[model samples]
Target: MDEQLHILTGSYALNALEGDERASFEQHALASEQTREEVRGLSAAAAMLAYGVEPVRPPQRVKDNVMAAIRNTRQVPAEAVVTDGAAGAAQRGHDGGVRPGAGADLRLGTGEGSGPEHGSAAGAGAGTDELGARRGRRSAGSGGSGRARPGGSRPGAVRALAAAAGVLLLAGAGLTGWALGQSTENNRLEQELAQAEQTQGAMLGILTSEDAKVATARMADGAVVSVAYAPSLNQGAVTAHGLPELPAGKTYELWLQHDDVMVPAGLMSGASAGSPMMALLEGQLSGATAVGITVEPAGGSPAPTTEPIMVQEL
Candidate 1:
């Protein structure tokens, strides 16, 4: 019992525990500030989880199902009064009489009458009255329909409908989250593709210009890297071949020598022994005197952290 009461903390925080369990947990929480604080923290976390996701509108099918449940379920009106038609008819005929002739017919308050108009045999006078009385007793407050009691409904069906509605809400939220995630990822990829296209266009302009100048450098490991510059356009492209692979968390970074300071250009792409990697220099090239390469950490650095592996004078 003690263990169960302790377990109610989470349910209490989410407002799921009710009746006796909720009352018990509230009493237990007042005995210890630590438990009270824990409940507060859990409650805040649950609220954050609910607010973190975007809300989605429920689908049409869910609305239809709920409406169908409401329409099928019978509700008792607060001041409704049911009238027993058979009992009313029997009372009206308290002075019993013989079954009337074929031409004689009578009805009171929409209740059946003992006559040939109702296909009653000549000998069914007392038998019909007894049957009517039995039906009236069986369905005293059922408006003489002789069916289930008025205002009764299938509680199990109502509960099942509620459970199904909860499931649909969860499913709708999951699908909405997935759709939002997909949209975000697609936007990122499209931006990257557009930037790549712009960079490729700039690099081609520099390399194909008539005023383009070329410079080459050789690394200690016999790798050849070159830069093509168009001074008129202030743009350039660096191409490297036969560069050896470095360990994880290391990269080749480029720098531009401007007067007395080394300005960071960008990180270089990896190259295999036979395949060449080309990259566009990030910034303007007209003021720089030379281009240099250095080995830096994975995401390059602002300042040169090591000596240049190769330097080519512009």
Candidate 2:
């Protein structure tokens, strides 16, 4: 936990942390005034460096319209351009997107097969031709159509569209991340819940079984090892009380003896003088007639490397 606290300083200034992580960092920061001030100063510096953009003066009213559009705003009826059947049909077609020949005049740069982008002057001429064709059609048709000329959208409208696109992209990324996090959390909780249910059911079966047998042994440290075994279920519940906490990278492990061989049963750690720990030995005692507990390295040894501190005969 202390190591995790030390690592939070790197991300504290970015405002990028998710829930629980942010709260934990905040608590650590509050506890250490120096840490709090350091984070604050770093946050201010990061803000400036990340946003040291040069000033850009966009067209008048671009800010207002772009913000309003991003907020899903509505303007007065008088300000809206009315659209009837033909205009609506055009909108639906655009909404449906890129019908083969109706897409944008996209030009590829060099390296495209059999082609490179034309010079700026040629490109300008092409734009002019496209715009002129659009104007000619609008003039020839009924005035009820609200279609604008090619590239004729207002500067404010263009800004609004760009802002909308950016908002949508960010929103999509956020939703995808949230969904992945939810899936991971759900899987973790399900595993924990299943383990808890399994342990509880195994304990209940041992306690209620009519053919259950119990044995106990006294350790050199004065701790007691107890085992409740059920022959019918081939399972046992083991408990140790008054265990002394071992040094770092050391733990206690249990084993079940089948004839001359002793197989791993489970591992126990962290229990102290007053606290007790329980473990379930499912099917480990199926063909075994006795159990043993021994000291081993952390994560438990593959097989016991020392004599048993406690042993119980069935």
Candidate 3:
């Protein structure tokens, strides 16, 4: 039930946690309903945020090149197998005193040299058979080792190429995600900047108006609420300092009062107990004679549900 774990809900919802940190948080979340609910809320928010961004598609050329390489690459052949019969034949040829190169002539002389009184035909036939067997075995064994076959190591090369292609694909995907995230962040910052500019403009109008009137009320705790109202522009800006923090599920809500009727204004930014904050009051201020502050539900109520903590006549 460590309170510090609550801060990780954002990162967890974003799937940014890794290894033991991820496991530990998940375990803690299962045991704590508050943490679990927070994680769910944050996750839903993250999902909505993702849906807000436009989708990005990778270029077709990257896919085309990877597929083309896979299709064009050749498969490596299995190594040849040598049999016991071929070994025996080679042994016999060596024992018969037949020179390796001279065994070639035995095939050509077999038919002419055959005769009933001579055994030359039998001798020539045996020599030719043994020589051919030896040649076949030699070719089989050297198919994987000798210079005549240059593709012996192609299997390793093909595997390496495929691995490289996989790495390239992953890198490209990562870069795409990074670019998309950055774009979303930039858009958010731009919107925030535009809003801040608008707020500044409104505040300046109220403070610089020729008919502007400023009012203030001080609380028992020494906190102060101030409002600047401009009759010419029908707008007012509320500023507060040293406002005490309320209990959970409660917030400070502002109101514009016209006679006995109160209109809902904006809520405070929930700053710390003794912090300063300023916000332009919502709605027109022409008929409103005063501004009031009250403690209400977390989100402000449509009508004031509590007594005014402070009221300043404008």
Candidate 4:
């Protein structure tokens, strides 16, 4: 068996597969009872995980202040199917399972409604028809090149799985086998969250430290972005001002460059070209000598597209 296939079972169980992969894996799973059972167990654990988090109200002025802040900014329009970060439900389409977008690419850790992704975002819609068509073909399907339609089996399956997971969780459902792996996956998610919290804490420390270094990247149009980093912790943040908002289908992607290779750092949320927003750095930054930002398509690119509009040496 392909090790990668085995690894994806957990993400699939969580309904985390990006568009193309999710359809392919479901087809493969239909033939393997082991895979099917694993999905069920993991789905149940996911339900329990959802119940574990405690919801807290945002600060009293948060909404008003945020809304006021964004009132001056223009909205960036997009056509991709975006998912709810936690619920994993597909954003419903106009038609019912009728037309799926070109392809459902999986973009994890993107902000929804707002962080290119925050926890996660999956392409949904046309999911029902896409899965159905792929199932009809009986082989790995091709890349989708159109838009999303009304229905998708995968999104429906996600809803069903969440429902089942909730039932299993509340009912103390026990399986003699496969339960441990499910719990382990839940633990893995918890660990990841804990690590993210730690990173945030580290970033806070770096930003506050007097030893931190700062650099500013100036755009041709008089936009100024200030970046601050701590070499000791390998973390940083960007603050943008006076920049022009991009048109539809374009985004600003940050990169950490070293050894002539560019590692993705972070994505800036949509804001008024002249409005101010700060985004923390993502990805590893060791040995990085400079940071840059570029324009790319909606979801982002595997690599930088051209000369960066903003570049500042560390």
User: Over all chains combined, what TM-score does candidate 4 have?
Assistant: 0.36
Deviation in angstroms for 49 in model 2? 65
Model 4 regions lying over 4 Å from their true place: 1-203, 270-273
What value does the lDDT take at residue 266 in candidate 1? 82
- Against the true structure, candidate 4 has what lDDT? 0.45
Q: For model 4, how does the per-residue alpha-carbon lDDT over 230-311 read when each residue is reduced to its tens digit?
A: 5433456665666678888887888988879888886774223444545556666667888888888877888998778888
| lDDT against true structure, model 1 | 0.46
| Candidate that beats the other on TM-score, 1 or 4, i.e. the better one | 1
Candidate 3's residue-wise lDDT over 136-162, tens digit each?
A: 222233233332222223221222112
- TM-score of model 1 relative to the true fold? 0.39
Q: Candidate 2 lDDT, tens digit per residue, 152-208?
A: 333222221121111111111111111233224444443433333233334433433
Identify the leading candidate in terms of lDDT. 3
Deviation in angstroms for 249 in model 1?
1.3
Where does candidate 2 have its weakest 10-residue lDDT segment? 120-129
Go through the candidates in order and give each one's C-alpha lDDT: 0.46, 0.45, 0.47, 0.45
Model 1 ranges off by over 4 Å: 1-188, 271-275
Global Cα RMSD, each model: 37.6, 28.2, 38.1, 21.4
Superposed model 2: Cα runs more than 4 Å off: 1-194, 270-274
Candidate 1 lDDT, tens digit per residue, 1-314? 25666676676645576433443453344333355445434543444466668999999998987675444333322111112111222224444332212111111111234222212111111111122231112223435343323423322211111211111121111111112232244544434333332333333333323355767667788887877665544566677767777788888899989997889888886323344555666564668898988999999999999998888888
